[model samples]
Structures are given as C-alpha cells and as structure tokens.
Target: MRRTTFIESYGATCKNWTWSWSFVNKTQRFVIFGAWQEDSHHIAGRHLILDEHWATRIPKGSTKARRQPGYPQAIEHLSRVAEEGYALFTFPIWQASVGKTGAGRDPSSIGRFEPRLTPKTLVHEGGMWWAQDLSVVALHSEPDVQDDLADVGAPELGRDEGHSKPTGPGHYFPRDRKVREDVLKKSGEKCERKGCSEQLRYKSFLDVHHILGIAKSDRVTNCVALCPNCHRDAHYSPNKDALNKQLHAYARKRPSN
Candidate 1:
C-alpha cells in the first residue's frame, strides 16, 4: 500500500524541509541528508503539472514534480505543522507503477526545469514528478474523477450491456436504458444500418442512435438501433448527409404501435 506524509510549505520559514535516503545502490550504500523541495517546489527548473489522463505525470518531468521518496517515510501526529493554505503530501512509490497519459515531452527535452515558474499538483521525487490532487477535482470526486481521464472515444468495458462510460453529450445519444431497449427491440435484435448483419451483442455494440441527431431530437421515433461501427460513422463520417437520410427513412418505415 502507498503511504502519505502531509507537509506544510510556506514562502519564508518552512521553505527548506529535509529528507534522507539510505540503501545499497548500484554504486554503494550511503546516507545523504539535504533540504528537499516539497510539492509546489521543484528540484531546480522542472515544473510539476498534473496530466488529466489517468491523473498522473506521464510527461517525463512528473517524477521531479511530486518529489516522492523510494522508501516508506512517516510523520508523527504531534509534529503537525500549521499553515494558512496549500499542504504538500509526500509518499513512497514503486516507480514502475507510474501511469503514462500521452506522448510526453517530445524528443530530448527531459529533466530541465525553469527556475521562475512554480509547480502545481506534481513535485519531483526521485528525479520525477507525480500527480497529486487534480486541479478540476473536488466537485467530481474519486471514480467520477477518473472518468475525466479516459478518452472521449474510448470503448466501453461491458460492450454487451449498458454504456457505463461518459459519451460526449452533444455528439452521442444519452444512455437512457429504456430508450436503448426500445430501439434494440424495434430492430429485431439486429443492426439497423443497411448491409450490416451484425446482431445486437450487448447494450453497447447496439447503440441507440438519434436519426435527427443527439443534440437535437428528444422524440423516441427519431432514435434507432445501430452497430458500434455504423453508429460511430453516423456521427463522425464526412458523408453523414446521405447516411442520416438512410437511417431516418429506415426508422420511419416501421408502423406505429
């Protein structure tokens, strides 16, 4: 399990806190004590910024941003230091577990930190930065907070069932369970797109689509059942004008119950 040590860093008095690492390295086992820069402060120039993707520091400079130690470190209860705002929390980590969000600092630009700028959530620890509290969090907490990290076009986990992921509101139809079932039933458990024989496998593969468009139609008749592939094209394909007409005609052909 990971451990957290809360620290207080103020501009004046508590600027320089101390840390020591003792272990047998490839060179030798030795102990060194020095003033460590907590959270908002970096080792030198590296700025610690949080990647919204997986809420981590995939951009190489992250290790230097979070200032995490390799081994477990603790703070006593009585040793609590008081400050007006902003507390730095330090912890030990398994370096391999660090998350990668995107193609970090292109080419040869790593380890360099600008002296003037201050870091936000990440601080360099063991020569890398780690993500702390996300900037867009507090209102969106924990699991929902993780949702923000996933890509807008990412696939759902339960493909055969209800879509549990957030689809960009204006682009995709809402995950209304009743509407989903109604559309799937109308299609006779098959994809409504012409030439597509794909049967409804789950709530996800067979998406309940809006023939008029997700952003415009609220009427149930405007919706239809489409396979994932056709559904994607219906919204993103450059030839949507023709495809929308086809889907609208297909859905309207069914007699009203």
Candidate 2:
C-alpha cells in the first residue's frame, strides 16, 4: 500500500506556534494544529483533541473578529478531508451569529483541525453547524485513531449551563435572523416551493417561511425558502392549505442533517 505522509511530513516542524507565522506563512492550504493559553502553553501529541475551552483561543482571520471569507472554502475543503480520513489544523476565530434574517454567513470552526464533516443535529429544528466538537491533532501521542470519526452520529444541540429562558416555549422574537440564514444556506438559497424560481435580488429577498406555522413549530424541517409572493400565499391566500401541505411534504422529504 502507498503510505500517506501529509501529517507525518509536518511532524518535525509542528510546535507551539502562533497563527501569523505558522498558519499565514503556508503557501498551500493547511490544517489548524492546536493552540495555547496565557499560562499553560504546550503541544502534547500528534492527533489528540484539545478540550472545548481552547476553542475561543483560535486565531482571528478577519477584522472585528467577524466571519472570515475563507470559512465556506474551508468547509468544502474539509468535508473532503474528513471523507479522506484526515483532520484539519489551524487556530479558531470569531463566528458572527445569524438566525431568522437569513442574512449572514455559514458558521465554520476557526481553530486548528476541523472534523472534515462534523456531526450535525438531525432531529432538532435548527441545522446548527457546531464549532466545538472538532478534534485537535496536538493532544494525543498514540498511533493514528483519526479514522475513529467514521461512525460519529448526530448529537443533541446541548445548551451550555446558565442558559436563560427569557419566556416560556416559543415566546422569543419571530424574525429569527440566525436560524433562517442557516436554513437558506442549507437549502442552497433556491426556492424550496417545488417549481418556483425566485427572482434574484441584490440581497436575499426570499423569506424563510415557516411551513408548519411559527406558532406550531419553528424547527428547520418545518421551514422553506420562498419568494415574497409565495411567502404571502403560504399564509393568507385562499389556497394556503394546499400550498402549505406541499411545503410540509417537501421539507420532511429532504434530509436536514
């Protein structure tokens, strides 16, 4: 067999390093290795994952710590990397939040070592592209266990401790800007209402319509991308019942995770 050596090749030079020199200097695409903190700073192993706390320390790639442009390209690249059974190496950066507005960018992890295709929530309403579960290649000293990720399954969208429930179920704002954008991105920004072709606009004009009614369910599987006219028809038009049924069937028929 032809032994692969990308990871092995970097072994000699991989060390406790900063992003400016290590990450930015590479002429080719690179993986985030690992990161350090103010007090405890050291590279441990080759494929070991760092604790969740280290995520925030990943380097910034954009101004004001905004969503970096390299994220989508990274996702496309890392998805292949994961399938090829390789992990990414890099520092983390800030990910701006976007929900119902459907106006922001797809969230990707900025830290070293992305999970080729990280696990996503299937049953949950939001198709959240989680950032913290990725592995760090600098923590483990054993032989390669990177292939262990092949069987990884969908996990719950676990809420961190001290999470505040401002009101009872579904009392939050309706224009959920962040979740909507994720749905649109997942849907490829095309109108999900069967054969409808949404007229392109300068910015996104398609409403992330709730097929099952927001009062009933605001989950991802219950949402659909629709033009403004189709959006109104899904609600107040005389044929709304039939239109809504079509959307529901479409939403459930497609896979979310």
Q: In lDDT terms, which candidate is top?
A: 2
lDDT of 1 by residue, 1-257 (tens): 10112221112122123322211111221111111233343323222322122122234544444332322221110011110112333322212222333333311122222122122232223333332333322222222111111111334432333334433221211134566567667788888888996995653456666665332333457776777677667765788668878888877776662
- Output the lDDT of residue 167, model 1: 33
Query: What TM-score would each prediction reach against the true structure?
Result: 0.35, 0.32
Top candidate when judged by TM-score against the true structure: 1
Candidate 2 residues lying further than 4 Å off, grouped into runs, are 1-175
lDDT of 2 by residue, 1-257 (tens): 11113333444132322221122113343344323221222222111122323222333443333333443333333343332223444332232333322332222332223222222111111322122233321122111111122111211322111133323321212245555766677677777777887653534555677665432355677777776567657755788789989988888777754
> What number of clashing residue pairs does each candidate have, in the order they appear?
23, 33
Assess the local accuracy of residue 185 in candidate 1 as a C-alpha lDDT between 0 and 100.
78
Give per-residue lDDT, candidate 1, residue 212.
57
Error of 1 at 252 (Å): 1.5
Q: Where in model 1 is the C-alpha error above 4 Å?
A: 1-176
